[model samples]
Target: MTPEGKALLNIVILGFGFMFMFTAFQTCGNIEQTVIKSLNNFTASGYTSMSIIYGVFSASNLVAPSVVAVVGPQLSMFFGGLLYSAYIGMFIQPRVWSFYTASVLVGFGAAVLWTAQGNVLAINSTGTTIGRNSGIFWALLQFSLFFGNLYIYLAWHGHDHISEKDRQTVFISLTVISLIGCFLFFLIRKPDTSEPIPSETAEGLQAESTESISGSGTPRRSLCTQALDAFVKACKLSVTKEMLLLGLPIAYTGLELTFYSGVYGTCIGAMTRFGHDAKGLIGISGILIGVGEILGGGLFGILNRCSHLGRNPVVLLGLLIHYLAYYLIFLNIAPDAPQAPEEGTDLQAYITPNVGVALFCSFLLGLGDSCFNTQLLSIVGFLFKEDSAPAFAVFKFIQSIMAAVAFSYSNVLQLPWQLLLLVVTGFLGTMSFFVAEWKVEARRRDSAYDSI
Candidate 1:
């Protein structure tokens, strides 16, 4: 198969794989209420799950590049997919042990999957196609968010509590979907032609224009040694000026996700802190997020193809969308503040973020999100195409840490404070990337000269 064909297939398979897991994650956002039904918890169940999940996930990046180096991208993803299914399987067991263990597995799996994905997409794409491919990938992945939320609306809309039957059914179904994602891994074509890239200077440039995941040559070392060497090399690369320029934006991916998926729903979706059930509303919001992602992805994808309207412009437009959504979301934060409201009545029903307005906010949030995520990945894939594994591993690591931090503070921080933080930090994140774009332009010029 042609490199482009393989790249397209991998992207599609990954989108399909993500659809199930994203849905599974979104379905029971607050597992304490839905699955565990814990009454004595201080932290929100959403935080509990995200912290556990991303905590482990972040830690695993230390080894992801090496793992990808040793096993190759396709097999790495296959293993990751297999482990990812365990997360959904946790729904069936619902035991504390099952939950935490699955969280670890899923976290490690996510690191592996993301590392492989970045490497795969980066390896196959050229400067010309990177932005479009990344956008397309993000667009396809949103189907999971859209359809998952749709499933929740269809199956559990009216009910406050999710039954074992409902949980189990969704679990079983998405589990199969995840397994299918793994199956697609087998279809990916690994490059058996490239020699060890002893020095990826000329070879790296050639590799980028061709099909090679490890742009650096593979040394004949033991698995542990290979991974250890990769880790050290990757770490050195991570601290370089070029890579550090991207830190803020990469970290923002985590914060954005945590807020959109976790905090926003908890704070604004309900009619009151404890009044109307927000599950249905949040589910609907997920659909809007998916809507925004697809639209943004599509727009960026198109613009990326045109030299006149490439990545930077779309990302700038995303900043506008993000700020707009921020104000829209602000409208939903009731002055009365959030209470556990698990059992009590909502005091300020009038101000609940559960109307068309909230939906609009959600749509904007999703739309805005597409710009950062798709573009960041594309930038990393293109700029560090030769070192895609390490660069992406670093990206994933920061992303996980930011997510964990967001979740940890989500409950303790006041609604106003959280929103304030997101606003300030999100702006910083985007601007950081904007600055990094200049560096990328310089690098691209260098690459063009080298190719010449």
Candidate 2:
């Protein structure tokens, strides 16, 4: 194909890939709600069964990155999607093992989808453009999640009084979506091949190019070499006495991941505790989050342009808002209080001021969380190189580990304490931005001195 044709094909493939990947992501997000509803109706255990499902999925995130590296991104996604489809299908049978197995498959698929999507974004863009592209990609992915929940809600609503046949229908529909996602993988064009040049050759080319750009000036390395050098520089950025200050941001990133994942789940639980029906509250929260995400997408460029405080400060602010949102939710739930009686037992006793507070908290949670996530991506773009897919992948791997921890802990912990844990997690997450900032500053200083 001609170069223009190839470029067009590349763009088309990337767009379709983004859409499919986002769809896959939405499917993953919808699973918890689906499983919870299905299990509640099918078994007596109800919410307890849902917790087990969360644990299985959480564990899967811990292992997903390595699995993706081994399988290649495309195949990883395909396998994940196909397996996830089968897992959802198994829910038709409604055994304990089926739920467990399905949760694992869903987790595995989500991991692959996230990793592959990042890789695809990396392959398609460069420089600052990479960050912008990634932000847009992620924002849309979040939107897809909103729609996924809506789709599932509609499906459930249509079969409101779900008989065995209706349940089977839901499973079959999910399976179809998963399989379609898998098939969509074939459309993703392979990334361009640019073999890594040796450091010496890269330096030489950079020097020559620098000389050409600046007549009578000393030669400097090429952009590619500069980027590789930056990566090496980032690795050597240090975590010692002087560098300890910079390591703060990396640490904060971890904390944020823990807080966000954990608190969101806890908020949903809190809502349920406050007499809001699980179905209604989850759907509302999803809608609020979707709206927040749209707002975040619109604010991306504006936030990126604000250089006075820089990306790190913006991220910190976002995290602070998120922290407050979670705190509000926690306060509303009164975690230490005794569990309210079941639905039929004095329903009026359960309905009170606490319920209103919880609903508001859910809305805030969506808004604050979306802002923080958006800023976090922008910060990653500013701090890392264009081809920082591997770095970003590693970052996500760490985030997933933290998320898994939070998810698991939510299942095991009580209400008030879980909120406390989330707060601590968010604080730690906020600290990661500082670490990243320090590293960036140190690199700037080092680069300046190296030139001297």
Candidate 3:
């Protein structure tokens, strides 16, 4: 195939697949950030439910590397996405057991899909173009949030309260979209990678190829064994001072996601002040976030292409943006803002949501979020280019676990403290990059000595 065909295929296949899949999952899952909350209203803590999902997502790191190692990105994404479709189906019945079980399935799939997607982006694009490609991926993937929000707005725009049936319909719609996304994933051909990462060894590729078509000669390892080995290597790597420091920020990414997409949407956007128009406002928040992501991601690419600032600066900028956004949220709502549906009932009767302020926060959250995530993607994919799967898995594992922690505390914590924690996490994350200057300097010195 021509270079153009390969690039086109990547964009069409992965791009649409990511967009539609998230559209189905995040839409029904995220709207007003209340899906899990509503489901857990009678039986459990919403944050606990969400934490189960994220914890499962983190644990996927154990098995995802081996899966990708054997089957390659194309099949990994397809199968992982198939699992995602199944998880979405479980939402039809929102029982605790169902939520937790589905969470595990989706989490495992998320690890594979995300790990493959990142490696795919790195392998497919040139070093010069990687940032731009990453930006494109992020910007397009976020469009799902906008589309999902719009569907919510159109369907339940004027209702003061949505019926369980209406909610079921929402889940059903999302499930159909997710199923379509799984199909798109299958259309993605195995990449003929130009700049394959180190983990994509020629020997491994040959083994996979031979095994696929002919059988025999491919050494087999049990999934448990593969996962264990990957886990051990990644854990050793993860504990380095630099990695631990970097982890501080990656952890924040999860926390930020839960805040923006989880209960905050329901607490601040849905019940605060919009009244019957709350659903529409929630959808609007998604649109603003989507638009902001487009601008932020596109700008990241442009800056990478046009300037020498590289990625670290973008991380710094994202941190500041988040700080400012959180400040706005705190000013409008109480520092002790409760994110639980049960706790929010009183606030629903009384709390004032500063629409202008809160919506602005949403925009910044998306913008800043894109900046942090996109840059992180570029940096990690480049840094761990050789051991891509394990490295990416560890990084995501950090992100998922941290997010799980944050989500677990969502019900107990106040907004002010949560935002403060975010600031701390962002600082640590950014500081991690800054500390890497030493590593870069050491490498340069070693290279210089070798040349001499």
Off by over 4 Å in 1: 1-15, 26-44, 68-75, 117-137, 183-222, 272-277, 307-313, 335-354, 381-386, 438-452
Q: Say which candidate scores most in lDDT.
A: 3
Scored against the true structure, residue 44 in model 1 reaches a CA lDDT of 31
Where does the lowest 10-residue lDDT sum fall in candidate 1? 197-206
- Cα lDDT over the full model 3: 0.69
Query: Per-residue lDDT of 1-452 in model 2, one digit per residue for the tens?
Result: 65334433554554555455445444434344334443454442222433343344434544454454445566766776676666566666777666665665666566556655544444444443444554555554566556555655565442323356755765666666656757777776654433222222111122233233223353355445544553454344332332343233443444444433333433343333434354334444555656765675567557667565655666666666666766665555544221221221122222343645555655555555655556655555445443334334434544555555544554446556755655675666567656666676778789999999
Q: For candidate 1, write residues 143-165 as lDDT tens digits.
A: 77877677666665665655668
lDDT of 1: 0.67
How would the candidate models be sorted by TM-score, starting from the highest? 3, 1, 2
Q: Tell how far residue 110 is off in model 3, in angstroms.
A: 1.7
For all predicted structures, in order, the TM-scores are 0.78, 0.68, 0.84
Q: Give residue 235's error in model 3 in angstroms.
A: 2.6
lDDT of 3 at 181: 84
| Residue-level lDDT tens digits of model 3 in 30-122 | 552455544445465556766877898887666665677667777778788887777677667666676667677777888778767765665
User: Model 3: clashing residue pairs?
Assistant: none
